[model samples]
Target: MDDRNIQYIIQEKFHTLSKSQQKVATFTLKNLQFVGVHSATNVGEKAGVSETTVIRFCYAIGLSGYAQLQREVTMFLFNEGNNSSLQNYLQSKQKLIENPRFYEKTMEKDASRILNISKNLHEEDFNRASLLLHTKKKIFIIGYGSSNLAAQWLYFTLNLLRPKVVLMKLETNEMIRSLQEIDEESVVIILSFHRYFKEPIQLASEIQDKKCEIIGITDSRIAPITKYSTITFVNEQQEMSTIDGMPALISFLNTLIVGMTAQDHDYYEKQRVKYDDFQNSFIADRWS
Candidate 1:
């Protein structure tokens, strides 16, 4: 879980916390993990505040000491915090009335998350996945919850660019039933983010016995299920105080769709022409 209490601090103490205090708060909210590792002096130095102000900031937040605050920061940064679902970041707020420092810090956090994930998207994995997507007989997807929706979206859209695909829903027994039938030619793509459903990894682990490929779309390298993934693309999983959702992972899926589509020019052109012809013939009749 991610922290839900920070926004309350931004709301209640925005006017009261001095400029230096506000910097401390914004910096902490954005990079809690970094602060957790830094000493009080280092933290204060980074945020352009005094060590006393850092300790005072911790005390202001109901924490006993800077060390206690650091522990909570660790929990939140490492996704071990006993906090509520991260829907606080999904709220809607007008930019005109928003906390500028908080919003800026939120953007910075997203950038850090995205860059960190980019750093982990090993090039060899990308090349291997591109080849797998191009050569695989079929693409089978697995995901539950939000990841399920993303899987469904990928299944529907990728068909326009590739060949056969399947999203054997999150049913474990059914997955096992289907897994037993899939040949070595088939590929599995697992879509999951925070609190990843365990069943996918279990299914993939089983499929590994048959020498099948596994791909993962997840939140971060720190994610629990990542080591099982042959190829994992980590993307920012929305960290704003008022944003609907993260679309970064979808952008990568869309990229793969385009890459596979570009592989064979004639096939792509013929499919586009056929689809356009069908659309022109059928869509206009319904509209008129």
Candidate 2:
């Protein structure tokens, strides 16, 4: 397998790539296994671009042509922490069907990979992010499409540790009202991943104009949200099932929540005690 970092190329040069080229790049990156064995025309059709655009995208990233791109992708599949090609990997997994522990093994591998990736995260970045969340006057969390779940998780967890946290509504008018409340003292945490949505990007741009700090929780450096973020936590996601797998992202959020709590245990304890008091009061029918 070759050592080419195709992801870095697409991310670093994304701004320069034309709209069609960008589309092709996104499709290629997501379906590298297909690209390794398919023709430029097939890829172009799948990406809704022409074969010429696909070839241009390959050259735009410094590859000689489609053939070289395939070769590189094939190499990437083989070298992706496993010494097997894409085809071989699929074959091996298929052969495991009759095995008693196949499903368990699959689950274990996925979980292991998700956790292992977190190890690459820098402590300094976490510290900076924790401090920002801890000190920011207000924190607004937003996500769209499939990412909304992640945004909600962060909002709920962070609110438990502090106050003035809100999960922004997805409706345009409602979100705009929340946006109007933002200022330099606000910190916006945006969750975005592949098949990137447009509203979040627009929201980030608006947040940028407000001069507030943006914390981007996304899947890659290439994610559009990162452009406006003051700090970014990139947790690579996988299509482990019919839907996207977000164990890694959830884990990262847990880390941030714990880090923020550790930053000031007294505040967290007070908040917890207050929550308990409210629960007790409700139980006693003390409120009208």
Candidate 3:
């Protein structure tokens, strides 16, 4: 029990405490966000208290210490923000690595989401993306934060499948500047999820000028979607108990990659032959 997650603990038993303990609770309630990047001193300063008071505040809240408290607090906040069930499964797997129940529950939910998308998989969207994939419009996949890795993965993956696919994960303010290249019929795929991206949403809105279709691979069919989207694919990150886990999204994209690779045999064969040769020679030695 740590004060890092003081907000949750306080919420659980705020009214059952004494006056001094309540003071610390009030401070934490007011500025729980500050705890994310700040130390006890910084939080105390914002809470109108001294460093030692913050330490006592930690104990007062029933946390073992400040550090443990922070980890729990972070997890609580993260779980609260993310609603992806994929995260739920991955975390459960980590927690219950040796348990069969975790895998059983995880695969059930994972299969559900995956099968749902597969059942609802729109051929029209695939056609739209395929049409753009084979064409030339400087395809840009805009993702940031955790999705940056996804964007980069797509960038490389799509390169072997097609060509000239770029993953753009610029600063929030710099998104509009990147939209300069968006012209008539330009393909822009926006990838995002919890915590959502405001800049990409804005860019998608601003992309109305382009004749190109904007494909929104979003968590939902909501704002920050493309104007003339020929197809829309929403990758759902399944969360267990509000945790915005990423495995589902990753699995979805993995399917997308496999689908795209299967659709283009010439590209896949050439890339695979070259890759296997390189992998067996340069990389296989290390693995062996």
Candidate 4:
């Protein structure tokens, strides 16, 4: 509603709409370009609902009417450009499902998403985020649901590059206690995507109140976490689902890790060597 982000608006109001309207919403979200170009009657036919239901669906999602819906969809599609259109991405994904080269096609899709990060992510923000990771006194990484995997990976990798890197747990009491240790010098990296869990946003808000720097990695620029963040990296997922965003998120984290290490190559290289030595020594001590 705030940004004319039709997808976000539909998602927010999806559960409140009627079954027929929900169908139209789902169809419109998946086939944005088609909805933009076609009439309400044609869209309803494709969604397997009546034209009236389609118009109602538009209003249900807070649009003025069918015309406004079309305009919103058109603006969304135009802003996304031809390359990143949801319709084209969905069409390609459907084709891949029927193709014999399943593994290759899957990797190709992920590769495309990773490439998109370079285009979408701001260079200045990336550099500043890397610098924060390199110099911050303490670092905390948090992500809920599927995003936790990326958070854990970053915590593990970053822990080797620097000390005092904590992987924040999702438990309420634990998170509250962890807050006591966080200060302005601490940096919190949060990974949140579609179907975003509220815990991270809440935690980011708390961190913001403490004057700590928040680095937000999310699918949308308007994601709630962004409001509380000092730097944000938007990794828009091709699909509507949550898990599909992992590859790009991990790739972005990897690039961030590389950038952070590049800041003081000699120091981080020494840290990695020390970590490897400790691991080998621990293994020998346990085995012996």
- Measured with C-alpha atoms, the lDDT of residue 80 in candidate 4 is 59
> Using lDDT as the measure, which candidate wins?
4
* Clash count list over all predictions: 0, 0, 21, 0
Better of 2 and 4 by lDDT: 4
Q: Candidate 3 at 21: error in angstroms? A: 47
Q: Which structure is stronger by TM-score: 1 or 2? A: 2
At residue 282, what lDDT does model 3 achieve?
A: 82
Model 2 accuracy (lDDT, Cα): 0.78
lDDT per residue for candidate 3 within 1-288, as digits (tens), equals: 422234445644555665555565676655556675679888767767777776776776676777755776677668667735565545556755666677676677667767766776677776657656556457878877656767777787777655557666566545555677667646887776555667677666677666667777765433235333556776543343223335566666676666666666796788778877976798768877
| Candidate 2 structure quality by residue, lDDT tens digits, 1-288 | 233256656665676899999999888877888898989999999999999999999899888999988877776566564642344446546756778988997777567757766776778988988888888899899888768777888888887778899899877788978999999888888888765888889989988989888889876765788788888877653331213246567777888888888889898899999999988989889655
Q: Give, for candidate 3, the lowest lDDT window spanning 10 residues.
A: 236-245
Write the residue-wise lDDT of candidate 1 on 1-288 in tens digits. Answer: 233444333334544677777788877755677787999999899999899999988777666888887776665555535333554443423342377567775556555645655565677777778778878888888877657777888898877666688878656687767787677898888876655677777777777777777887775443545667777766644443212335456557776676676667787788889888988989899898
What order do you get sorting by TM-score, best first? 4, 2, 1, 3
After best superposition, candidate 3 residue 226: deviation in angstroms?
Answer: 6.2
Quote the lDDT for 114 in model 4. Answer: 90
lDDT of each: 0.68, 0.78, 0.63, 0.82
- What's model 1's lDDT at 10? 39
Q: What is candidate 3's TM-score against the reference?
A: 0.55
lDDT of 1 at 4: 46
Ranked candidates (lDDT, high to low): 4, 2, 1, 3
